[model samples]
Target chain A: SQTIHQWPATLVQPVGSPLSLECTVEGTSNPNLYWYRQAAGRGLQLLFYSVGIGQISSEVPQNLSASRPQDRQFILSSKKLLLSDSGFYLCAWSPTGGEQYFGPGTRLTVT
Target chain B: AQTVTQSQPEMSVQEAETVTLSCTYDTSESDYYLFWYKQPPSRQMILVIRQEAYKQQNATENRFSVNFQKAAKSFSLKISDSQLGDAAMYFCAYTERSQGNLIFGKGTKLSVKP
Candidate 1:
């Protein structure tokens, strides 16, 4: 069975600080990875997705950026965080294009 | 572009009852996929059910099922014998077969009464 892991289950960062969130998948190779953010009581917003290493497509234009450094490792980063950047961040993986499985997620709070 | 819509912001059902959450999507392409995801209080997104556009039969997984009306562009999720554990925010999502990226709806919050 395949499983996804995310680091820093919860994070608190000061405004203008750097941000880094990591996601990794085990038991699967060459899987599609995605980064999503959900505001309080709102639905998810797709930030970025990668089909392969070094390849990334961004859906929303914001301060955040994503990278696929390895086949199963994905990283979401920002040089300077904004107050609007605080939200629940989710990492998801899909074998094909149909169903996606999500990780535990990271709750980021920018003060 | 493909778009998904979930009109209901919140819904509630008593335990052991059946509840249906409505979803509709707009797309120009014929080859696509629809999915329902559950987000609990923990905020973990879980796949509840999925429907393929080419398939006529509705998809069912255990106590959860989807009503896939391709022509109407409607895909609804039905929860049978609802349990307290079923309480969560449900989201409707659509993705093109070749696109691979998913477009999600606003989501509906479901509450199960004990």
Candidate 2:
């Protein structure tokens, strides 16, 4: 069985500070990875997705960026964080046309 | 661009009763997929059920089932004998045949009462 893991289940960052969230998949190779952000009481917003290593697609333009450094490792980063950047970040993975599996998610609070 | 819509923002159901959550989507692709995901209070997104657009018959998983109408572009979820554990924010999602990215609706919060 494949599983997705995300680091820093909860994070608190100061405004204007940098941000980094990591997600990796185990038991699967060359899987599609995605980063989604959900604001308080809002829906899931696709931030970025990667089909393969070094192939990243940004769904919405914002203060965040995503990178696929490895086949199953995806990282979300920001040079400077904004108050609006606070939200619950979820990492998901899926095979070709298969069901998507979500990670536990990281609750980021930018104060 | 494909879009998923869940018009009902919230819904309630009495325990042991049936409740249906509505979802509709717009797409031009002939081959695609639709899914219902449950985000419980724990905040973990779990796939409740999935249906392929090509398949005419609805998909069922235990107490959960879908009424997938391809022509109507409607895919509604029916939870039979709902339980307290069924309370969660249900989201309708769509994935194109070519793209692995799944588009999600705003979600409908389902509250189950005793």
Candidate 3:
């Protein structure tokens, strides 16, 4: 069975501060990884997706960026946080073009 | 470009009854996939059901099923014997066969009353 992990479960960052959120999947290799954001009372919006290491496809243009440093390790980062950057971040993984499985997610608040 | 639409912002159902949440999508591709995901109060997205465009038969899980109308571009989720645990925000998503990325709808908040 494959499982996905993300941390910190919750985060609070001040404006202009750096941001880093980590996601790692165990029991799978060369999986497709994705980053999605959900604002309060809204649906999810895809931010970025990676089919392989060092290959990322961005969907939304914003302050955030994503990187797949390893086969199963993906990171979402930002040099400076904005108030609009606050939202719930979710990490998901799929087998090639298969259905996606989600991580526990991280609640980020930028004050 | 593919787009998913879930017009219902909220719905209510009685426990042990049935409720249907509507979803429609637009896509130029013939082979694709449609999915229904549930986000509980905990906000974890859980896959409820999925339908493949090539298949004509409706996909069904234990208590969840889908009405897939390829021509109509309508895919609706039906929950039978609804339980309190079924209360959640349901989302409709679409993806192409060659694309791993998904396009999601606004979602419908389902409330179950006992």
Strongest candidate by DockQ: 1
Model 3 chain B is weakest, by summed lDDT over 10 consecutive residues, at: B94-103
Candidates in order have lDDT scores of 0.94, 0.94, 0.95
- lDDT, candidate 1, B1-114, per-residue tens: 678999999999999999999999999999998999999998999998888899999999999999998889999999999999999999999998888788999999999999
Question: What tens digits encode model 2's per-residue C-alpha lDDT throughout B28-109?
Answer: 8889999999999989899999999899899999999999999999999999999999999999999877786788999999
DockQ of 3: 0.79
Q: Of 1 and 2, which scores higher on lDDT?
A: 1
Per-residue lDDT of A9 in model 2: 98
Q: What value does DockQ give for candidate 2?
A: 0.74
Tens-place lDDT digits, model 3, residues A1-111: 999999999999999999999999999899999999999999999999999999999998999999998999999999999999999999999996757999999999999
List the candidates' TM-scores in order.
0.98, 0.98, 0.99
Q: List the residue pairs that clash in candidate 3.
A: none
Q: Candidate 2: where are CA atoms >4 Å away?
A: none
For model 1, which pairs clash?
none
Residue B97 displacement in candidate 1 (angstroms) = 1.0
lDDT of 2 by residue, A8-67 (tens): 999999999999999999998999899999998878988998999999999899998999
